[model samples]
Target: MQDVKADVYVPGHGPILKGASALDRHIKFYKDLRNIIKDAINDNIEATKISVPDTFGEPDEGRKNMTVETWLKFYG
Candidate 1:
């Protein structure tokens, strides 16, 4: 979107966003998630033990509803 210089962004869920500033939170969320997963892998933590933090913000309902076990099976 930013590469394309789109004026508006539509996510898979939730309300539409406008402009670069609107993407800040989402960009941070992805960056944080990447860091979390990397650290967990480095620590040899089981995927089943990993949980998304509340500080990561409200996940989509589908993701919010997914269990840790489900995530493990999906990612592992």
Candidate 2:
């Protein structure tokens, strides 16, 4: 969406985001997640240990987060 310079985004869930703040937050979430995965991989950590909720020590409040198992399925 950012590549296209979208002015608004309507996600599958929730209301339409009308500005950049929401988009920024969305991007930050993915960036953080990717960093966590990268760091774990670099440290030679096992894929089964990489879990979103476990890494954060709490459940995600609203978003549907992915598991490391899913990441391995795609990027392994």
For residues 1-76, could you state the per-residue lDDT of candidate 1 as single tens digits?
6676777899888668787777776677656666666677668787655656565465666675464445444445
Error of 2 at 75 (Å): 3.6
Error of 2 at 21 (Å): 1.0
Candidate 1 lDDT (Cα, whole model)?
0.65
Compose the digit string of candidate 2's lDDT tens values, residues 1-76: 6665677988776568777777777677657767777777778788656655333355553332445655555555
Superposed Cα deviation of residue 13, candidate 2 (Å): 8.3
Score residue 18 of candidate 2 by CA lDDT. 74
Clashing pairs in 1: none
In order, candidate lDDTs are: 0.65, 0.63
